[model samples]
Target: MSALLRAEGVGKAYTLRGKRVDILRDVDLAVRGGEVTALVGHSGSGKTTLLHILGLLTPPDSGRVFVADTDTSGLADGALADLRRTRLGFVFQSYNLLPQHSALRNVVLPYTGRGADGERHARALLDRVGLAERAHHLPSELSGGEQQRVALARALINDPPVVLADEPTGNLDTRSEETLLGLFRELADEGRAVLLVTHNPAVSEAADRVHRLDAGALVAEGSAA
Candidate 1:
């Protein structure tokens, strides 16, 4: 099967002060359907940079990103946005929820416009995340784990083919982290490509494959513990 998401010889850099600092170099990776792939690295090791590139939120300085065999490099910004909407779901460490919106509204916001069906779908997702009772609550009223679960529901709102998470469990306690990880595993089991960037040892151990990022490249690969 083809990779749902792939990066070939990908490179990224930033102008830090007067010099160009390389964040990723010659990075090649792929996430296939029915599997969870974990990218592990220390802080500032380009894990997030690579995730952004894969998500098409950032352009790579070199190399290419492919979504199911289509090179994203040739797509225009609007086209990229459309592809991202239909093909990719993203979860962030910060729980990037709209504080003003209720949990159900936040999940429905990803769709074009609000409708009865959309609300029903969003509510089902909230229920899946064990937040059905809190669907009407605002982000501030939810605990950290609840907020992250809401974010996860939002990510799946579109039923995309791939899910990319950056430090998804960074803020949760052990139980919450386990809950999120199980959801990720379920996503993979259902044939979605799940790629997550995490420094947490337990998260890495739960994946099907673990790739370590170091010195701007993929330094190692092994089966999960």
Candidate 2:
């Protein structure tokens, strides 16, 4: 199968004080279906920035991002939003769950226009993520692991082909990190393109492929299984 997500010659820069700092430069990435690709880099190395560009959350200063072979550079804001809603799923370092909503409600929020069956689908996703029992619990009422599981379930609710996560396990303990990593692997096995930005060695060990970002470029690490 072809890559579900691609970035070619992508570059970004920001003005810090009087200097123009380059975050990424001529970076090329290909996230294929049925694989978990881990991006490892130090702080301020632009891992999350690249993830945002791949997810269409931020536009790169140069180069192109392709989702399912469709170049996103020319898409209008509305079109980009539509693609993000229908083609991609994102998970952040923080759970980013609504404080006032139940886990089930949070999962269903993305499926708002799907009518009444949305709840059923959300419940099934909760079950898939091993959070069925916590469906009605608030974020405050759940453990960090449980809250992250809820976020994972919510990301999968749309069944998007590409899943982008940035430092998703940053706040989790070792066991919780392992649990989430397992889910990510499972998603890859099921043919979703899973890309996550993480500094953890365990996270890279669990992936099908590892890419290290340094000085605004990506270098493949290790061989694929």
Model 1: residues with Cα > 4 Å off, grouped in runs = none
lDDT tens per residue, model 2, 1-225: 579999999999999998999999999989999989999988988898999999999999999999997999989999999889888998888999999999999999998356778899999999998989989999999999889999998888878998999989999999999999999999998999999899888888788888888978886565444
Estimated TM-score per prediction?
0.96, 0.96
Local accuracy of candidate 1 as per-residue lDDT tens digits, 44-115? 889989999999999999999999988999789999998888899999999999999999989999875455
**lDDT (C-alpha, whole model) for all candidates:** 0.92, 0.90
lDDT value, residue 35 of candidate 2:
89
Best by lDDT: 1
> What local lDDT does model 1 show for residue 3?
87
